[model samples]
Target: MGFLEVEDLKVHFPIKGGIFNRTVDYIKAVDGVTFSVEQGKTYGLVGESGSGKTTTGRAVIGLNDITSGKVLFEGTDITSKKSKTKNVRKDIQMIFQDPYSSLNPRKRVIDIVAEPLRNYENLSKIEERKRIQELMEMVGLSPESILKYPHEFSGGQRQRIGVARAIALKPKLIIADEPVSALDVSVQAQVLNFMQDIQKELNLTYLFISHDLGIVKHMCDDIAIMYKGRYVEQGTKEDIFNNPQHIYTKRLIAAIPDINPRNRADQFKFRQEVQKEYEHSYDDYFDSEGLAYGLQPISDTHLVALPGKG
Candidate 1:
């Protein structure tokens, strides 16, 4: 079985309206989204804002309710029952986007990092303190800083604190919901590289949700593109980066900043061409309701939501 598999997952929020406030319509935050993560691999979920990439990650970790479908973790259906178990919760962790808000300003660093340990394990006081210290050091924070509050640290350090907290129980999977988007460019690189290093050391699988194509290219082993709550394309990093099949994916790739002065003219021309194709062929990829079609397999590792009858 895959390390983690989400099968036809959907998260719909009901829109209440009228005096009676009866069922009006649903906002399909995640519609039929399906993907899997292997042990020690990073899967990138990339899209523009409001594309439901963040919602997908939240649903995987049980933060958002699943309207339908299954989430399997190591062959067990976590969506239905296993998600409630202490072991399952311990195995799956999340690092939220906003470090400042995610970490409680009222609590000291030790309390924030040790919160997971207290929930899942029955470690002695000394052992818990030792564990939190080790986690701090692992994320490049000094052990002595454990007494400091969240606001005392820099933005990057606070984020690392979040990272330390996420990995406290040595989780098998970590849902990183735009983990670096809140940081500066240089800090983003530092955090991303630190995450990569820890993934190697701890054999952690990551569901990386982000809109930055450059960061996705740097960190992800596989990539999936989402639009309007539906998956448009999914494949290996090489496939998506080198030979993107979906128009949305192509546009995203073309938008990645190219620093080479020599390729300035070529890059601009390529983006213009992609934009033209996207504008002209938009209807070819989406239906009248502006939703993508169901994904169809093009290769063993590649799937695309091409418009037409299956």
Candidate 2:
């Protein structure tokens, strides 16, 4: 019933070995992940490296092929039917991790931003030119910069070009794959604020995948903690922050250091208190098939993964 839903999705890559190269085994990059994104909201995916958060986001956007399961947009499965990919892709756009490499230096900014226009629309010469100028202005770039190449701008400016391109189509769901991870600390907040403004103005949905729990807590209304291609826990922002039920989730929070020793000590004490709470609720989790599915109700907005068996 959500605007976008991913059900039991899996992506596997073959691990080839030996001379003949028979299918030795498969690396489960993403395994049986299920979640939904509602319009005008953000759902964040946070985890360590190799946890398949990127893979899952890629699968939903058709960047990576779906080995199994369904990715539904507006109640229809786009993964099930290849012909629908082009149409489905328009509604969902991705802002890739790197800004420098993502944009082409050879092409001018106008052409780069207009690539999506060419893909989904058959605009006339005058129409394409007009649209590209508007896009440049939308993401805080001057229309004069339209003629400039990627090399003409700094890192933050280049990222603004990427943002312009992503929003050109006015997509409903924007999957930001660590969009700010590459920028300087000062620039990161500016870009983040821009994204927030766009999300509010357009009522756009976002699947923000990042390793930084601090940013996750700042932007996400809800959080899903993934481990080894498994969703170890998921809940609202307040729930995960105030009452984390998973050990991995607690560890991530504790590791976010405050420069002051006193603040750090307080965080350590808080971790100890939460650990005791998790221990008390460990027995309530149950197994589903080969995977353990833990769902503990906390508040109307918060839910925790079943503790233990991680």
Candidate 3:
């Protein structure tokens, strides 16, 4: 069994209406999505805005309520109230998107990193401060910075602080939701590379969620493309990048910006062709309501949403 598994996970929100605010309808944020993360590997959940990628990560970490489905960690079903033990909670943690707002501006860095330790470990004040200092140093920040506040650092540094907080408890799996999207282009690589280094050193598993295919290519072993609360395609990094089957996956891959100016014209032409094909064959992939069909296996490791056999 995989280290982390999500089975037919569905996270729907009630759309209450009228004066009484009774349940009217549901927003199917994550509809029947399923995947698993192997130990010490990165799994990417890629999609556009409002594609429910973030919601999926949140649901897995217990930040968002699961309307239905099971989230199993290390063979234990944590979605059930009785089974989600403290050890399970510590084993699973999340690094939220947007470092600018994720860290509490009011609190000092010592408190931020110590929050997890306080809950999970009974450390004395001296021991806690020493541990926070070590965590700061691990994420490339100075041990002295633990006394500072969140507003005192740059965006990249703030994210490093967030990382320190995430790994403070020595978590086995980290749900990193768009961890670098909010940083500048120049700083994005630094954070990504540092994350890779930390992952290797700590032997950590990651649920890397992002909308940037380029960044996803740099970081993930397996990938799943999400749209409208469902998966359109899923495969190894090579499979999705080199042999995309679904029209949506092809379009997304085609949209990745080619940095080399010499190939710009050719890249533009290819993207235009992909766009044309998507526009013409939209109905062939999605149903009348504009939703992807259930996934069908195209290969051993590749699955694409397609019409079922008659």
Candidate 4:
């Protein structure tokens, strides 16, 4: 089994309407999503905002309630069951999208880094201090500044601090939700390289959630493209990028403002490819169980999800 598995996961929030608070429909934040993450690999979740990327990440971290479906860690289900999640959380950690908001301005950097260690394992105060300082250096922050607060650092440095705090406990899986979106272009690469280096050094599995296709192309081994709470397509990086089989996926790729912008006709062709993928399924195939997420054989290690209703 994969290190992490999300099976038919759904997170729907009730929409209020009418007088006396009638529950109307539900906003399908994450609807019937399914995927698996192998150990020491990066699985990129790509889509526009409101496509359920952040919600999926939060659900995986157990911060948000999963109304249905199963989130499994090493084959054990962790959906709404608190007891099944204890050990799983220790191995899994999260880096939030905003570095500025994620940190506690009141706490010292040292204590922030040691938070996980304090919660999971009862380490001696001295040992925790040593490990926390080491983690600061590991994430390119200076240990001398451990006593400083979150407001003392710049944007990039704050993010580095967040990264330090995330890996302090030596987690196996790190869910990085746009970890560099708040930084400048130059700073973004520095952070990305830092993340890649740590992944190699630590053998970490990352569920990288981002809308930036360019970053996704560089960082991900496998990619899943989401649209309106559903995965419109998914595949190996090569398959999804070079030969995207879904309309939503194709459009998303084209949406990446080309460095040397393509001509109108070439751009038109790209749009067509995207639209073709969005086309309805043939009579032979029926969408399964609202199977917005599935494995259509593009090749080994490559899969695409088609839009159709069973």
Candidate 5:
């Protein structure tokens, strides 16, 4: 079994309306998603906003309730609330998007990072201070600055503090939802590289969720392209980038900005061709409801949502 497994996970929110606020319909945020993350590897869930990438990560981390499906961590069924043991909670953690709002404005950096340690460990004041300092140093921040508030730091620095809090419990898996999307482009690389460094140092497994395919290509070992709450394609990084099968995947990849001036013309032409193909063959790729069909394996490591069966 993989280190982290989510099988057919679905998260639906009740859409209440009318006089009594009864459930008239359900908004299917995450519809039948399944994947696994191996130990010390990053699994990328890529999509635009409202495509359920964040919802999937939230469900796996227990922020959102699952409508159906199973979540197993290291072969333990932690799907239900009762089944999620204290050890299981300590094993999994999340680094949220928007560091500005994620860290409490009222709390000092020391308290922010020490919250998890306090919950999961019985350390004295000196021990907690030492551990928080070590984590601050690990994320390239000053141990002395632990007394300051979140507003005292830049955007990237706040994110580093968020990272420190995430690793405080020594989690085996981290669900990072758009970890660097809120930061400046120049600082994004620094945070990502530092994350990789710590991943190697700590042997961490990551469920990396984001809309940027460029970042996904840089960070992930396996990639799944999500659209309208379902997966359009999933494969190894090479397969998804070099051999994208789904039209939606093709469009997303083609939409990535090409920075090379020499290749701009060629890139534009390729994007135009992909767009043309997508417009003309849209019906061939999706169902009547405009959702991707269930995943079908094209190879041992590649799966795509296609129209027909073999």
Candidate 6:
């Protein structure tokens, strides 16, 4: 079995309206989405804004209530029973998108990182300090800077601090939601490379959720493309990047800025072609309401949402 398996995961929010705030309809944020992550591998969840990437990550980590479905960790169902056990909580952690808002300004770095240790592990003051220091050094931070507040650090430093906190408990899986999107380009590489190093060091599995295809291409082994809360395609990085079947996936891949000046004209032409294809073949890919069809396997490691099945 895979290290983490999400089966038909659905997270729908009630749209309350009218008198007494009665439930009018449901906004299906994550609708019947399913995927799996092997131990010590990174799986990328890529899509545009409001595509349910964040919601899927949140639901897996117990931050949001799952409307229906199962989240299996190591072959055990942790979906409904996450809150009942501290061990489950300790095994799964999250690194949020905005480092500025994720960290509490009022709390010192020591306290912020130690929050998980304090909650789950019965460590003494000295032991906690040592652990936090180890984590700080692991994430390329100074151990002495533990006494500093979140506001005192730069944007990249704050993100490193957040990374330290997430790994403090030695979690097996981390749900990183656009962890480096807030940083500048240089800092973004620094943070992404640092994360890769720690993933190897700790043997951690990452569910990396982001809209930046370039970053995702750098980090992910397997990728899933989402549109309107449903997966349009999922496959190995080679399959998705080298050979994208879905029009939306093709469009996203085409939109990635080509740094080489030699390919400028060719790149522009390719994007135009993909845009024309998307406009003409819109109905072929989507239903009447414009939602992606269910996933159908096209290869051993590739799946795409299309109108008909083989």
TM-score for all predictions?
0.97, 0.89, 0.97, 0.89, 0.98, 0.97
lDDT of 4 by residue, 16-127 (tens): 9988788999999998898999999999999889999999999998988998999988887778757757887888899988989999989998888888888998999898
lDDT of 3 by residue, 16-72 (tens): 998999999999999999998899999999999989999999999888899899999
Model 2: per-residue Cα lDDT over 87-157, one tens digit each: 87898899988999999889998889999988999999889888888887777888888999999998888
Tens digits of per-residue lDDT for model 1 on 212-259? Answer: 998898899999999999999999999898889989889988998898
Error of 2 at 271 (Å): 6.7
In model 6, where do residues sit more than 4 Å from their true spots?
Answer: 81-83
List the pairs of residues colliding in candidate 5. none
True-structure Cα RMSD, model 5? 1.1
Off by over 4 Å in 1: 81-84
| Candidate 2 lDDT trough over 10 residues, lowest sum | 283-292
Per-residue lDDT of candidate 6, residues 66-179 (tens digit): 999999999878898545655777899999899999999999999999999888889999999999998888988899999999999999999999999999888999999999
Q: Least lDDT summed over 10 consecutive residues: which range in candidate 1?
A: 80-89
Ranking by lDDT: 5, 6, 3, 1, 4, 2
lDDT-better candidate, 1 vs 2: 1
Clash totals for all models, in order?
0, 1, 0, 1, 0, 0
Candidate 3 structure, TM-score to reference: 0.97
Candidate 6: the clashing residue pairs are none
Off by over 4 Å in 4: 261-295, 307-310
RMSD of each: 1.4, 3.4, 1.1, 3.3, 1.1, 1.2
